[model samples]
Target chain A: MTDDKDHYIRALFDISPAYDDAPVFQQKVMMGLTLKSWLRQGLVVISGLIGGLYALTQFVRMPEWSLKGGGLYTGSLQMATRRTDATVEAGVEFIDIMARGLADSLFAVGGYVQWMQTPQFFWVSFALCSCILVLYLLNDAQERI
Target chain B: MPQSPGHNSAQDQSDIDLIGRAVTGSHTAFGELVRRHSGALRTHLRRMGAQSSDADDIAQETFMAAFERLSEFRFEGPFIAWLKMIASRRYLKKLKAAQKYLFTDDATLFETPDEAPPPDMRLHDLDSALLQLKPIERVCVTLNFSAGLSHVDVAAETGLPLGTVKSHIKRGLDQLKSALTVPNSSSHPIASSQNGAAGSATPTFMDERR
Candidate 1:
């Protein structure tokens, strides 16, 4: 008899009301997931930008200090303004000199750039970008559906 | 349970497949899951005495939390069961925060006994029948019957003493039987006896002795 009562109660509980708000509920949950995804992606992108900027500054500073012995900043500024001629020939020559100096700096920093391309850094960057891209595509696909 | 409109289209995909997709950041898969189970979960929460708005809020929180921790979910059980567990815990947490105690001798708990809805009104549906029970009793009964949790599991999940959980379930079942079965029906002798034993008083743990 007790078993019967239990069964009856279970049966009663099983009778779910016809809830028609599932679409609305699903929309709310999906909206929540979208918001969370965007927030997470935003954090990742912001952190990556900050880290990349810091690393770039460090890379640029290290090479300048090592190659030029701390005179690169003032020296470049003086060189660029030293030939302030109104003639187009002088301006062209000044730009040519600046471009050559930039090339020299790039060559000086070649070792550091190669180090950044090593397997460890390359793989880490690849994996991070891949994750972000996959997340973005998934979110976009879900939104479209 | 009534399926959402798109439930059929997603029915071809297994829950594990959907979960795998969701884990990889598939919102469409997760949305399908939400569509498939939200009705039953919402109904379960309502049976447990959660107001409609509270049920929706708790259900939303449960799904959001489940999404955040989808990787932690083991594949040993049905996905709906996992969803129900999440929703139940969310509802219980909300209830605990509001009421502080799951079981109490507060007079409000007994108010329904004296002001019992008419028999016809109570028999209108199982939800109405459940509403006749105290909050604790309703939770215990719903967890046991609706969520299909064992007594031990319900006690553990509720953080209530096992004995208290059992008594609440028994009393709750008795009240529900009395409310649901046609009054004075000879075929259901147990229901009739339970009604007599229960009387028109606020249920108390003390009454469990009888």
Candidate 2:
């Protein structure tokens, strides 16, 4: 403990403190996982909602065809193609097939995209689960302590 | 076998008493562990060449890990020795990460003239001289001087054999003494060489109460 004065340790202590990792990174990850969980839940909720809306659509069926000359005669499958528009008349041959095909295509695309997102959904879910596990482990370790 | 709160059949009552008290949610006892051990831990990190910024986090993690594994603290010798080993290993991990990030507390992190340490050499140059040492030399210097750990403790912390720790400490200190004496800065003050006294050879740790 010889005193000569002017040591840097005193100054070293004065130079500002720096932290290695950002303080909020953990909190940000926690919130992101929560938002992702809700979005995934929203997908399932929206599917049920849209399914209910589709059931209501059945009550208001689309006309197979319309006759304009006689002024709005409702149509059926066996009715002759007597629509006013040439395009509508021409499309009569493939109307049912085209409508069914388009609906199928839309559903298929939506399902594929959802399936692709499953891994991301699962990872967010796993992160949340791990946080729970860590919380539990901390409790369990404390109990033993 | 039934025993009173103060008495137990378990081996080494001293360890059991401290651990049992800590286990029973004794805050003061745990605080005892922290106050007793944090200094040596900080020293261990310094040897690992970690930025002081990382030291407290590493120190906190060290205690957290120790408490997590409190059931396993054998308490065979000095608890400081045990803590030093854990902190040293953790510091190595942090060092690897720091290297990857191109950010380290070591004097090596700076480039050129700015890299020079403060001119005054009166205080324990032991810790700062550590910045000049090779990685292995730094670790060795940490275990002996900073941690005040025995050679065995140094070996245990580094996972090197006891003989290796002894040799590194002996050689490392010699090199450190020589390096500190060199006049790196003409502007740097050290009483202009003649006034500079030989470092009285600190006997590793100054904090023995731990």
Candidate 3:
């Protein structure tokens, strides 16, 4: 019995893992996970969408269109040139028009303004984020209540 | 992945740094971070007493929670503590849900590794003996023996006062000896050698020897 006990104890010290595959399997499940955050989940989604759009615009669209297409490329929005030189009128017009359009859209859309921005996609994104935050707050309040 | 690109012990510092960046909301940084700590955390979870079946799920939950709420983390020391905390909570919550007592000697909760013989005996009798002790005691012994963590590290990990950790270790050793020295009755659960030994003994319950 003494020898048996000793052998058992010794085996434990040299013990290999019981489940060799467990760590790998678990980690796969954990991929891309963050612990938790104060950031609202819905807000993250909305912000992510807005930011993604902004990036897509910068990388995918700016180089291609801001030239002949300019701010009026879409045709409905009109924007004033910021500089005396006409060389970059369209670029300046693009920024100004986007700003004004998004502002007006916010008022026109009211609560849903986030979904319908008239200006540059950036403010549309900002408004969308705001909408998400508001909705998150409502749900959060309901949870608390 | 099994581990991270850089952390194959290729460069622990670089991997840790990348993980820090991930915690800061860098998507690629987080990807590297996940690849780095996930394996060790899973292994640690299994060692910490999670069942093999649940270990993966628990590990996943821990990482996800860590990634999503990383901004709240303040890396005052090594980030392992944070990861450990996440894994610990996930495992502890499961234990709580099962109504298993974390502080007590509960062998039933830990599954037996097949490499070892006997249902009650742990793969290593020593670790098994340590497990038979109380939770804090088990933690001290594990850190000291398995992880090679110092008493100070144990205190840090367990939130016990430094001196208290030492005392727990001392007292835990004594009780473990008391438990182990008793003559093995074949019918006993530990004697059955299934999960590596439960934490009790028999006979005079006092008359024992090496």
Candidate 4:
């Protein structure tokens, strides 16, 4: 009789609001699956690009520190004056002042950049990007389990 | 052998068969599985004290989560049971998230027993009765009786101690019995489809009890 009561209660409790799947539900799931795959690929590409940029910044020849010698003075003067209606003398003065300030700021950080002279900076950048990519993939993989 | 009331013993594709196809990247197979089980899952959520719309939202999350991990399914039991397990977890997470905002006394909620319902008053009345139960009691009762999970399974899913689950079920059943059995002259909280037509009629749960 207890079994009967339990069974009867189960039947009564099983009564629920009837629902049918809206086509939109299926559409949403499929769209989500697509978005998830695309995001995975996109993250990989973004990490690779970041890694490439880091490598380039480390290996490529950056501008030398001389305000007048490195292309900074000529480049800024031409850029500010050639494409504008500004007087050449005024443009050269403006460019020279701006270049000097920028050079001073860069020189302020010269010690840190100098310390990064070895391949350590490249490896650090590589490691950071790789760690980010691995963590992302691991999160996705864990979700599957 | 007599099958359970809602068992779809004669369906063309068994859940295992459908799951097999789903594992091979068949969206149609998965969609079919969702269509097959979503109603029961939604109902289970509703029984657990979720408002109608919230239940549907949780059902959506449950299905999406289940699909992502479809390959992990071992097919050792009924697929509906597995779906229920996932839905229960989602519901618990939702309850945890909402704990900061809502406060209601289960004792106060059930204080007004409301008039006994008509003998034939079905779906809406059942929902109304369930609404009177405390959220945890409702979950325990629905999981054990409605969803057919064992006490251990309910405990495992709900993170409630086994004794607590059993106590909730016992107390819940008693309240349900009274709510459905005693046909008092008091006003019913939920508007019935019959509108007090079956005045002398036995309540649905009492009738089921006999």
Candidate 5:
């Protein structure tokens, strides 16, 4: 009886759980890891887009002198504020025209904060987000099948 | 799709290398880690008293949580131990959530007496016998007997009091001895034989026998 008890205890230690279709389980785990990051990935993309738009707005607001010379001029002379050069004034007028044309485009709602508040901009963002969400769900569903 | 230019088979990579790749968004590397560990993790959970489906669910959740926070892994410790820690946390959380219905008094759960086996009974396996012990006792015995962890290590791993851990192990062994009625003269296989199967679940850590 003592040996029998010992053997039983020993056998107990050796029992292994039998899982069916291990590779299938592995594939399922991989599918989950792949699909789980959608929310984080989407947030990263959205934030990156916002940062890019801000940089673009800054680039477009460059002084007329800088645009005429095709380079940024940060010297005090560039900040003189005098409307002496006709070419610089023309460059400034060209920028105003461009900004007005873009008034109805994506970035024209007075930079990121103001643009983010408009219903039209909201709908565009909402549409973009919806598309991303749909695509993410589609990929997840494909993996499931 | 074309093969990733520099990507190699995950089988050849060390765990640290796999973890590095996983942190950089290589899902295949992470998948390999999961394939390597899931079996042992499931076994561990089962031995800890989880039902088969619950064990599988917890294993899945453990891997998902580990992948989400892979960057936080410092690579200084054994990866399996880290995984075990995560699994332990998830198990504790599950226990806490189910405490209201599953256990009437969590502290005194292990106070039940061991059922006696008939004098002439010949035990062939321990599967159903294991389910007879309390959850904590089962966990302590499995970690100590199957995984070859020392009592100190088991205490550290499970975060149970040292005395309590010792008591659980002693009581568990006694109960198992009484419940198992195998023939006294028959030579039998050692308990550590299942170490091979458990090896798949735990990697480097299992090789270091206490």
Candidate 6:
């Protein structure tokens, strides 16, 4: 009885109306595909343009010491090494001051504040923010695609 | 009436070749696939209790998804089966999104009139017969019989309990049999006793593995 019922049901569902709208259906699907492709491509191009514009802005704002070569490069490297040593010293001093107590750490805190105001710090912060923004935009665009 | 350009050429290529081209981003090849399978898929969705407009929408969404995921197709089965699987999943998603609580375990919620008079067999098609069933029952039966999903697969697909899926299938099958079975008519023979034929109404691409 189960087998007979299954057979009858299969045959019944098999009797589908002959639809002549295949061409129209195909056109609709193709149009959807094309539109999605265009949107995805447009997103990628927009993301690339945003990234390019950000890079160009950063390039325009870049310090001459970072972009130049020869004497200025050597001087900048030396200056960067000195600044790194000074930052390390300040960090150690801040930790030591924290270990002692918070009251005597004004000079260390001032040194850290001065370090944060430097051009190198500003460039680093700008680059990090730009990278994060680009990555976020790319991720959003990929999810949309 | 003249056929579209490259229509004959596209038809000559096998589904595998068309899939390969579609994977490489050939809209024409993918369009051929859509042209080939849209009718059957739309019909399957309609049998699964989707309105004709909704069926077409779901079919279009399925094809679009298939195109995006063409590379994931392993070529281990018929392309039509893969397409149907996507369509079934899409339809289920739409059903769930539209009706948040459609697939409950309550049998009483899906009860049909068992003692109702049989319809005029001449005018009674499967679509109308399917309407006699509850939405969940129609979905379960169509997934099992039309979309070639097993009871467990249907349960997994619909997120319903196994017992509920089984009951739905059983009740849906009973209702369909009562509605469609011709009294003392021998015109319809059991087409094929195998799982492949029993799984699908129109046996275009029978994936026995399903």
The candidate that wins on DockQ is 1
Q: Give candidate 1's TM-score.
A: 0.65
Q: In candidate 5, what are the lDDT values of residues B1-210, reduced to their tens digit?
A: 766644446866778889999989888888878866676677666777776677778778778878877888988676765666677656755786676333333656555554555454336435455666777778778777655567998788667788888998888877676566545666664432212233233222222112
**Taking the tens digit of each residue's C-alpha lDDT, what string does model 2 give over B65-168?**
66657767787866665666677667765555555422233536433343555676423454556666666666766656544567887777566678867877
lDDT against the true structure, each candidate = 0.71, 0.52, 0.52, 0.63, 0.64, 0.69
Model 4 DockQ, alpha carbons vs. true complex: 0.11
Question: Which residue runs of candidate 6 sit more than 4 Å off their true CA positions?
Answer: A61-145, B1-5, B105-118, B122-124, B182-210
Q: What is candidate 1's lDDT per residue for B37-121, written digit by digit as tens?
A: 7776777788787877878888887888888889988998877778778888778877777875555757464556666668575
Weakest 10 consecutive residues, lDDT, candidate 2 chain B? B190-199
TM-score of structure candidate 4: 0.62
Tens-digit lDDT track for model 3 on A83-123? 34665776667776687677555444342333233365557
lDDT string, candidate 1, A21-61, tens digits: 55777899889878988998999899889678646744453
* TM-scores of all predicted structures: 0.65, 0.40, 0.41, 0.62, 0.56, 0.67
Q: Write the per-residue lDDT of candidate 5 for residues A1-145, one digit (tens) a residue.
A: 7546545565656555445445676788887777767767888899899868745654454223211232122222334534558888667666655654554343323345454445786678678879988998996553221
TM-score of chain B of each: 0.75, 0.57, 0.51, 0.69, 0.65, 0.77
| Candidate 2 lDDT | 0.52
lDDT of 6 by residue, A105-135 (tens): 4334444445555689779878997998899
Q: Which regions of candidate 1 are displaced past 4 Å?
A: A60-145, B1-9, B99-101, B105-109, B122-124, B182-210
The better-scoring model by TM-score among 1 and 6 is 6
lDDT of 2 at A102: 65
Q: In model 4, which regions exceed 4 Å deviation? A: A12-17, A52-145, B1-12, B100-114, B118-125, B177-210
Best by lDDT: 1
lDDT of 6 by residue, B35-118 (tens): 767766777887777766778888898898889889989997877667778888877877887874566656687666766645
Docking class of 4: incorrect
DockQ values of all predictions: 0.19, 0.02, 0.08, 0.11, 0.18, 0.16
Which candidate do you rate higher for TM-score, 1 or 4? 1
Tens-digit lDDT track of model 4 for A31-81: 776676689689889978965765555564445653223444345554555
Cα-lDDT of candidate 5: 0.64
Clashing pairs in 5: A4-B182, A4-B183, B40-B201
Give the TM-score ranking, best first: 6, 1, 4, 5, 3, 2
- Alpha carbon deviation, residue B161, candidate 2 (Å): 10
